[model samples]
Target: MNSKLIKELPDLVRNNVISQEVATTIEAYYQSQQANSPNRLFTVFGVLGSLLVGLGIILILAHNWDNFSRTVKTGFAFLPLIIGQLVVAFSILKHKSKTWKEASGTFLFFTIGSSIALVSQIYNIPGDLSAYVLTWVLLSAPLIYLLKSNVLAILHLIFITFYAYEIGYGHYYSNETPWLYLVLLGIAIPHYIQLLKHRTNDNITSLFNWLYPLSVTIVLGTFVKDLSELGFLMYVLLFSVFYNLGKMPFFDTQKLRKNGYLIFGSLGIVVLMLIMSFDSFWYIEELVFFAQESYISILLFFVNGVILGLAYYKKWLQSFNVFQYVFILLSLLYLGGLNLPVLGTVIINILILALGITTIKIGADKVHFGILNYGLFIITALVVCRFFDTNMSFVIRGLLFVGVGLSFFLTNYIMLKKQSSKAKTL
Candidate 1:
């Protein structure tokens, strides 16, 4: 219930459906109900104040650190940490409000990181930013659970992702493998699961949507060298996993940007299919097989196998996902030894067309203009691509472009008409 809803109540009263006295009572009731919810503005300002104070202290220390002796620098390094710790303790023991916990936890999270950095600088510790991030994230992870803070949870995800990029993906030199990143990623899962269980629509839920797909994207290349050309197959399956995961009840309802898996998966599938549509990719010299087995290749093969196994187990065919079935068909095409390359090209083209049509049908069912346009864009892109890829007559290409233009116009017109009809009914 909201005051926003009560604005419409005046219309009912004017039409003699209700009296002003009834409307006022209803508005008062809704206001009272809303007052019981947590104050978002208070929480936001609390968190912001904590961040500003923490950063301000860091800036102050950094500005004067060069003039300070070792003894003083060491004291300053621990000072913020001790203060942050005291604030957190006070929140736990006395305040215990959500606002206090969030503010204290965020302050301490930054303080601990700053302390670690300053102490390392003071001691001239030998480590890169990757190791520093790893240490900071490990120390800060407990804040997410102890304070039950979504902000800390998101911070953990962001830092760990940077750590993965730095160490796991060879952005920085580290003895650790990418597998360590995966293990570290697990630390945030419990907190994420808690959010999902209790606060499904909470803003923090959107961070998980972006973080997981981003993690996969960062790590996907770690095993690419091993799979070689067959890596494309693994990517296809991985994207399929993302797409299917997006289809789950929670993510399906989210906005497109918030539903990272769906957006990335759909675009990845389309792009990969387009690449495969070219005869050149199929006949590439690097398209070697398991002639030389590597751990990365073995891991990728296992992952793809698991995805296919799960899809078949759950019978995902009923969902009408073109890529899911086409993946299998494409693999078969590759294995059947019709190695002329054009065979793969032909299958891919057909698959893309079918996928485009299916996407349009799905958009029609959902009555979502963005999705409808997305499907239409896919088809239009295909035709445009083929205009260059194929040697069709100029007149035929012109006709195809004109036809696609008309299709776009007609679909949009129809959508507008349907929307108007619905508005009239309402």
Candidate 2:
């Protein structure tokens, strides 16, 4: 059957027009199952069940390790861990080992590592969170390399993430935490090297898949914390990531499927916008731009100009989105530099109207995707500004609101017409 028929066949079966066996057969024939790896549902359940039992043992030991002697407990303390390490070594040695052996060995090392540390805490080991995370991460790294197991790599990466997220975000600054950054980079290097050489292991790729952006964002966020002025700079940095990724020659579908550079970058942009909604990242406040702190204001303006210039250079200049920040900078200059402090409210309304009208014109005449966003920008800006600017004249403001309301339907119609015309040209 054709694609349409195949799609409809599922619904037909679901509606009880076909038998379940027949449906299953059709699905299997249409979707070929890869034969390299056999199904391992039982193996997975066994591992999970064993892990739970192991965890129960650790909790019991953690609570009652005090009654045992130093030598007896020391041997006992390392017994599970030593055994786990040996199992990992054995699994690695057997190149043709089954997946269960490989997975179980990695799982045992992980369990033993954590359990040993918890037991160590019973002996009153006095290490900080960073030190603790570092120790565990180092111990686990070899399992990743020796076994070439993503589970081991992923486990190490998870603990490394915890180290960075918990301690890095909450404390410390400067080059002192270079060790922590190094550990994170260490976790990434093996996978990055592999992903470049071979994009076959989707699971390993998926781990870095998440870990890279997460690690990058965490690092960057740590760098720019507590700096409102630098928040705009952070957006520029984030967008630069998107601009690069969207241009990269690599066609690995896994990269797009698992990673979210755009989502993270967009979040950074939104935060910058919200901060600018009050203090204005690119310029001084609305009414007071003329008498700005000249040095700081100029530096910030130049920074914003650089961001827009990069965006334009990359040809990623989505109209209203790029201009949202640009307008914040401009609106500051337009209202404050013009010596019209009392007319601030009027200027904001006028600004919204201008954006809406420009959108309609752009779609109608210019044939641009960026233009599609302009009316939404104006409408949202009007709504937001009105909510905060409580001192404005009611009558004049009421008229502006009504005027923008009418513009909405008109702009939609114009953009639709423009889009239809553009489609014809295509």
Q: Highest lDDT: give the candidate number.
A: 1
The alpha-carbon lDDT assigned to residue 121 of candidate 2 equals 65
Model 2 residue pairs with clashes: none
TM-score of each: 0.85, 0.60
Candidate 2: tens digits of C-alpha lDDT, residues 314-382:
666545543335334443544354334445435445544564565445545555444445545555565
Residues 1-426, candidate 1, lDDT per residue (tens digit)?
665678899998999999999999999888887776667789889999999998888888889889999999999999999999999999888957788888899999998999998888889999988788988988888888888887788788778777777765665334455566777789888888877788776666776777778777766655455444666666766676677677655677777768887887788889888887887767744455553323444464455567656757876545666755555665666556245687778877888998898888778777788888888998998898898888899999999999999999999889888888888999
Model 2 stretches astray by more than 4 angstroms: 1-33, 38-51, 95-102, 115-119, 122-124, 171-179, 200-207, 224-228, 246-259, 280-386, 389-426
TM-score of 2: 0.60
Alpha-carbon lDDT, every model: 0.78, 0.55
Model 1 scores a TM of: 0.85
